[model samples]
Target: MGEENKIILHGTWASLFSKRVELALKVKGIPYEYVEEDLSNKSPLLLKYNPIHKKVPVLVHNGKPVSESLVILEYIDETWKIGSLILPEDPHERAGVRFWANFIDQHVLLSVAKIWKSTGEEQEKAQEEVLEKMRILEEGMKSTNLEICANDLGLLQILLLTTFGSFKAYEEVLGVKVLVQENTPLLYSCVTSLNELPVVKEICPPHDKLVALLNIYRQNAFKSTTN
Candidate 1:
């Protein structure tokens, strides 16, 4: 492919959404240039690529920009049909993958934010919500034979992997065990397996770095609450 048609990804290392796109590209073995965005002072390139949302995880392919992590994932799957497919061939299985991906974005992610941003009664409520959501997710996984989606790694797996990886930071900051081995064995197993993947191990941010960032966020949240 010509240089103009090559893929370029704009994203931040810490962003779960960005990580999802990164994982997708890595899984598909697509070679792309990675541009890390400083969210505090975003680059002009990021703005040029994603003017509306102006967010990370923008996939620029063939000089065309594709925003939104899930949208980029589907685009990658459709564009590169080699390697492991991110969506199943069957329409129903594809829908299931989409459903779980949406669930992680709409429900699981929102609850995780609440857990870390709030305190006291509000934080406790958010914790309950996260646990409830995890239960539902675990049940969904159980029904689907414990695979992330269908029989192979797909969009849902990428989404959930990033979400759960971020949850490790939140769990430490909030002092809660969201994905316990005893309570959610299958989900825990899924997390373990996903982490062990070579691509994921190489690309996913280090756990200690995530925890340090979360600690800073926790301190700031406390300071704001006190103020």
Candidate 2:
């Protein structure tokens, strides 16, 4: 690919969405530039490029900007057909994979955010809601015997890593063991499977890194509260 058609990704290193996009690009063996953005002080280029969400994981193709991590993933897959595939080829399998990805994004990721950010009785309520959602997710996983992609990592595994990885910071913020083999058997199993895969094992962030970032995030949140 020429520089004129060069791909550039704007994202933060710690963002799950950003990480997913990065992994997709790396799997496709696409050469791209990475721009780390600070959400608090977002770049004018980022704002102009992704005026809709103004979010990270913005993939700039040539001069065209494509926002949304999932969309970028599809684009990367289509643009470069190298290495293992991210999505399944069969139509039914693709739908099933997307279903799981959407489910985790809507339920687990959203619920985790609420559970970690709230306080007092509100926090308790959020935690209860998260547990209910997790139960539902676990039940759903129990019924599925999905096949892995050529990459050895599928949508379900990606979603699982995203959801369970969020809880890696629980000890730092909630001061509790939120996600473990004992606490969340299904999720823990999925995470463990993903970890065994070379691609996922190398790509996923370490729990300690997330914990440190969460501590910083929590400290900043408290300062904002007291201010």
TM per candidate comes to: 0.90, 0.83
Task: Tell me how far the alpha carbon of residue 30 in candidate 1 is from the true structure, in angstroms, after superposition.
Answer: 0.5
Residue pairs in steric clash, candidate 1? none
Model 2: per-residue lDDT, tens digit, 1-227? 69777898999978888888877776666788889899999999999999988898899999899888878777776776787677878887788778777777888778777755667787778777777777777666566656532235555655566556556567567754456565567676666566566666666677788778878887776566668
Give stretches of model 1 more than 4 Å off. Answer: 144-146, 149-151, 220-227
Q: Write the per-residue lDDT of candidate 1 for residues 106-137, one digit (tens) a residue.
A: 89778877776777788889888987888898
TM-score of 2: 0.83
lDDT of 1: 0.81
In model 2, which residue pairs have backbone atoms overlapping below 3 Å?
A: none
